[model samples]
Target: MSILITGANRGIGHALSRAWQSSGTEVIQTARNSPGMEPLDVADPSSIKELAERLEGQPISTLVCNAGVSLDKFDELETGYAPELWAESFAVNVTGVFLVIQALLPNLRASRDAGIAPKIAIIASQMGSQNSPAGNRFIYRASKAAAINLGRNLAVDLESDGIAVGIYHPGWVATDMGGDSADLTLDEAVPGLRKQIDELTLSETGCFKSWDGSDCEF
Candidate 1:
């Protein structure tokens, strides 16, 4: 099957690309500056459109909207919460995911004819949970919350078309974003995620889930 993954140059995205590639799956990788992948600046609509055109005719069974960012200079409760950073995070984590799904709807539609179930996997976060303990990382949390809603809406909207949608927390992976104390390695995380993807059914769409397959509160 052919899959398209964003932010594929590093961390979980990079590991996912490797896992899929090793399994003989065709993977189209995207990142802002990664070599051999589409140069995607998720903040720019023009850039997104350009990447869409580049992959226009390809058969994409899955689209993993894995690109994201966090505020670099702002403290959680600071009055100086950077609008620019919030914008940047939302651009990639929310808008970018939406645009990519919209752009690739046709490719996913075509998968049904090939007897493959089309799917969209959005890498959201547990911090997005409105039901969880909060009071930290405002921008990042908001962005992921938006992503969760996006996936839920897409799951509902795309159900008639037979495309499954999932919003999953990849856990605190040991990526640059996750830091050294993070519990899981990229190897452990991506494979578990892939397994979750493989297990997805129409019944599972619109659900918030964790890497280990537990339901996460929305």
Candidate 2:
């Protein structure tokens, strides 16, 4: 199967790319930097369009939207807080993901004939849950909340096309964003996430799930 992952230069995205590659899967990895497995700036509309053009004829069975940014310092609402930080977070976390998925829709659609289960996985966070109490992560929470809604809507819209869309919380992984005190390593998280992706069916689309495959509240 062919897979495309954004922000594959590091952390969970990097680990996912490596895990899939080791398993002999055709992996198309993208990041903003030149050293990426493939070049893609998810935040840039022109860059996303270019990536789509470059991958025009390739089949993408899975599209993983893993690129995101967190303005952790802005946990508390303060006067004179940089509004640009919030905008930047949303640009990368929400708008970026949507643009990439929109650009790759054709590649995903083509996978239907290949007998592959075309899926879209958005890396979301439990902090985004409206059903849960809000934590200090104001910007991160808002971005992820938007992301979850996007995934839910996409699931409904793509169901008729036989495409599945879901969100996953990687459970405080030890990435730069997740910090050193995190509960899981990239090694532990990626494998479980891949397994969860492999097992997903149409019934699970629109659900928010943890890395271990448990359902999460919206």
Model 1 stretches astray by more than 4 angstroms: 72-76
- Tens-digit lDDT string for candidate 1 (1-218): 89989899999899989998999999989999877898997778898899878877767888888988867524846565678887888888899889888988988887766889998999999998888956778888888899999999999999999999999999999998898999998878888888887788899999888888999999
For lDDT, the strongest prediction is: 2
Total clashes, candidate 1? Answer: 0
TM-score of each: 0.95, 0.95
TM-score of 2: 0.95
- Give one digit per residue, the lDDT tens place, for model 2 in 104-143: 9999988977888799999999889999965577788889
Q: C-alpha displacement of 218 in model 2, angstroms?
A: 0.5
Error of 1 at 163 (Å): 0.7
lDDT of 2: 0.89
lDDT of 1: 0.87
